[model samples]
Target: MKNVTIYTGPLCNFCDAAKRLLARNNVEYKEINIATVDGAMDEMITKANGKRTIPQIFFDDNHIGGYDDVRALEKENKLLELLK
Candidate 1:
């Protein structure tokens, strides 16, 4: 399986949804809640190409973006492929 990392924030519905999607797929992920960690947002922005949104998901080196993006991958039947 690939390394799954997600930058999230508290109270973000999309973040919850993104995490649920991964969990539903049995994908192990590292969740970085920016709201609880200082400078995490900055790190997320730098890593995500300045995207300030919550649930910035990454699989290995591939940036999978937000909730919709991850769902798109699932819809296209590519999400599990990435997990492998």
Candidate 2:
């Protein structure tokens, strides 16, 4: 399976929703709390191709963008392929 990592901030509804979707799909992921980590937001942005948003998702070191992007992938039935 691909290594999924999510960069999120505290109390973010989108982040929580994204995590819930992943959980429902039984997707394993690493959650990084950018709120408490210095420089983590910057790193997330850099890795996400300048997307300065919370809940930046990565699939096996590949930036997959934010919650909407993830949901779109799921809608298109592409998320599971990436998970593998």
Stretch of 10 with least lDDT, candidate 2: 45-54
**In candidate 1, which residue ranges exceed 4 Å CA deviation?**
none
Give a tens-digit lDDT track for model 1, residues 18-74: 999989999999999998988999988998998999989998877879999999999
Alpha carbon lDDT of residue 31, candidate 1? 92
Q: Residue by residue across 1-84, what tens digits does model 2's lDDT show?
A: 999999999989999999998998899999999989899989998898899888999998899988999999999999998888
Off by over 4 Å in 2: none
lDDT, model 1: 0.91
Residue 6's C-alpha lDDT in candidate 1?
Answer: 96
Clashes of 2: 0
* Clashing residue pairs found in predicted model 1: none
Cα deviation of 32, candidate 1, in Å = 0.4
State the local distance difference test value for candidate 2.
0.93
The TM-score obtained by model 2 is: 0.94
